[model samples]
Target: MGRFITVEPGINIFVEDINPAGRKTIFFIHGWPLNHNQFEYQYDVLPAMGYRCVSMDWRGYGNSDKPITGYGFDRLADDLRIVVGALQLKDFTLAGHSTGGAIAIRYMARHQGFGVNKLVLIDAAAPSSVDKQTANEFITATLNDRPNMLHNLTNMFFFQLITGPFANWFMQMGLQAAGYATAAIMATLRDENVYSELQKIVVPTLIVHGVHDKIVPFAKGQETSKLIKGSQLVPFQYSGHGPFWEERERFNQLLIQFVG
Candidate 1:
């Protein structure tokens, strides 16, 4: 149910296509330092709920071509355009997590949500500026010690205390992400401002965030809800950065209700 779709001359995007014949499609964009596999859970659940689930790693992450350039949000948005065109996707609901969330916003702002009918953001890192002190510190830490920063980030994003096979699973996925993408993409992301785009989104939008999200604080979610005219915000009150994984059943139930 998955294959690589060529985005351009040399770029091939690896897409996980579930329920190939489902009437509606949901193109998923994963976060930084991770591939489309982050939505592995959704792949299993969404299709069964009568929706086609499609996800791809950004150009430089996962099994996609790791080109030397095109790591910025603008390029990321372009990549989505290429994928949708290649796949002939329509009336699709765009869902993005973390960095992917910001990319989805850019896709709307830059392209004006052409074929997309709805939007979903899961603990997105948006409305951030590169000039912010917090972002600058993160950039510094990522530059100075990438591995250490990733390790700390994993713990913070998942939960304060990670244990068992779940912890191992999460760590391995994070490790497999391209270091180049992780390092280079972060700076490009920090330079963007999605609040205006949020305000412009007229399609039904769902903003999902973990109340305990440390990477993209809960306040960011609240602000995003406020900015997006009719956007709805759902908080995973007892989870961290990844509510899809942390609260699978609840998240899926809510997502199904929203997308259906």
Candidate 2:
């Protein structure tokens, strides 16, 4: 069972156990508009393998307190710092997906003073990819008319595993939980430039991306891996955006091997 922990004044985070007393901790940060529940697959499987896994809901998502403030990378990094401090975690690995990957990179750049051992970025967005006029245009089109694009994006994530009734319910649940304000914050995410910051990250890092991911795209992952000094890029041939869900077993094995 998972428990709620208060990391900030109004933020209550959800944490699931995966070997509470294990030596090494794996702190998983979920993407935008989705909560810790997105990591349910990881939470259930990692613990039995003698690894401690922790996933927290960002402030406005999941069961966390939905404050209208503090939605940027710095603030999100602070939230994560508080959670780590409150838990007194050290020598841990950080794994993030999509927006969470951006946040994790920021956190490592800012807090390398603390002891973060390794990092894992799954289908992550690059810092300057938006600067390319074409990419920026695509982002603008998707954000401007998300409703029309949502179904296709959702389908791309699961490779059409979710469709019809199940897909509708899933999208509805995500929207209802995140709401418009969360979406607005996500829109502002493009402003962050992580390329400059990546040079400072000295931890051993792994970049995982699906070859067919339409959301962040595979090129971003390749570029990110190149930027992060000694980082390794792992490609998922048959998976799309949400490789963690589509290729759960392989993903978990890679995670264990990297963190081990």
What do the candidate models score in CA lDDT, each in turn?
0.82, 0.76
User: Candidate 2, TM-score vs. the true structure?
Assistant: 0.87
Candidate that would win on lDDT: 1
Per-residue CA lDDT of candidate 2, range 112-150, in tens? 726578889998766553345544543554557655545
Worst 10 residues of 1 by lDDT: 129-138
Q: How do the residues 34-74 of candidate 1 rate in per-residue lDDT, one tens digit apiece?
A: 88888878887888878899888888788787777788888
Q: Residue 17 in candidate 1 has what lDDT?
A: 82
| Number of backbone collisions per candidate | 0, 0
